[model samples]
Target: MPATDPILPATNGVIRRSGCAADTVAEAGAVSLDVLAARRARSLPPGVRYELKGVAFTLPPVRALPVDLPESAGGDTAELLRLVLGEEMIGRMAAAGFTLGDFELVCEDWRRRNGLADGTAPLLPAAVRPGGSR
Candidate 1:
């Protein structure tokens, strides 16, 4: 939540670019998106472009509001694009001097904009956690 964060943007996300897509998953109580562009911007490999047709977002396990619920139970409700790039992508970015926490913040910002819950969990895990039920 820095003022100038590219993902969150101080304008409350009103400056979103065209073509970004988002959706809410009622069962998981989360939101998702096909933010390949955002992922690429996060420093994924050049040839790693893949269409993320549908993905979900939720709060991390440790940060869940109700500790009793599995991390899968849901914590936040935001567009999936806010989640961030996958591990391989982050690895590539890290080699190029990207900080792990920075991209995590990007995902966190996405969550904030989508009205999703907040969690301290890392982005890589949270991004993949919802797929088990798929």
Candidate 2:
């Protein structure tokens, strides 16, 4: 069946488990929080300290779609996480005294949400499955 039937209710779902982190002291490739805290000690606020926390990514349970096609029913939760996280990372960094200059929020948001090698727009709104739609 053609995907354009509009039989399926377009939705946005949370992505399943996957995540990555980068720190200020991040090496040529990757850096950990401990290293970041140490390297940026002088610049960091006096009361600030390094804290490591993990974020879990998980696929939301499969949802039933009005459409008959299996593909149309499945929501890409992982991709959503990526999109949210990427945008969140920028905000997080800003709060941490860093800026996401030249980083395309849309691109990062898209790639993370879709798990694409390159960023892409979300086919559905992010809040739809979270009990809201916009």
Candidate 3:
């Protein structure tokens, strides 16, 4: 990826804000929900989709990683890893000896990469604000 490009490029294509791949349209890379919360930025635009290996998956515009959740929260490890770090990232981290406990560090790296400050905060869905219920 170019230093000027804010989005991360995948082997198949670009991962959109919605986590969908667009063969033609280049998109800004996925943003961490924590980063958005830290900056008080608005959520990503709606209706975005991600494509991988010619298959598309509908996802939220802002891809929030579950880096803050405790392991006891319970879910598929690989799926959780994918949600937060993306496929390529998970692979790289795994190759480098990443563990579940390192999720916070990954989140911190993501925040710093996006030029956001390092901090802890709950990642609420777009429909649910910090103090509001879904």
Q: Rate the local accuracy (lDDT) of all candidates.
A: 0.41, 0.37, 0.44
**Candidate 2: where is the Cα deviation over 4 Å?**
1-92, 102-113, 117-119, 125-134
Q: How does residue 44 of candidate 2 score in lDDT?
A: 32
Compose the digit string of candidate 1's lDDT tens values, residues 7-70: 6645333334567554334344443443644564554222222222132223332232232333
Q: What TM-score do all the candidates reach, one by one?
A: 0.26, 0.20, 0.25
Give the lowest summed-lDDT range of ten residues in model 2. Answer: 59-68
lDDT of 2 at 106: 36
Which clashing pairs does model 1 show? Answer: 32-80, 76-116, 76-117, 77-116
Sort the candidates on lDDT, descending order: 3, 1, 2
Better of 1 and 3 by lDDT: 3
**Candidate closest to the true structure, highest TM-score:** 1
Stretches of candidate 1 off by over 4 Å are 1-84, 120-134
For all candidates, what are the clash counts? 4, 12, 7
Task: Tell me the tens digit of each residue's lDDT in model 3 across 21-96.
Answer: 3333234564335534644434533433443333443433223443344232233333443654457755666666
Error at 101, model 3, angstroms: 8.3
After superposing candidate 3, which stretches have Cα over 4 Å from the reference? 1-82, 86-92, 99-105, 115-117, 125-134
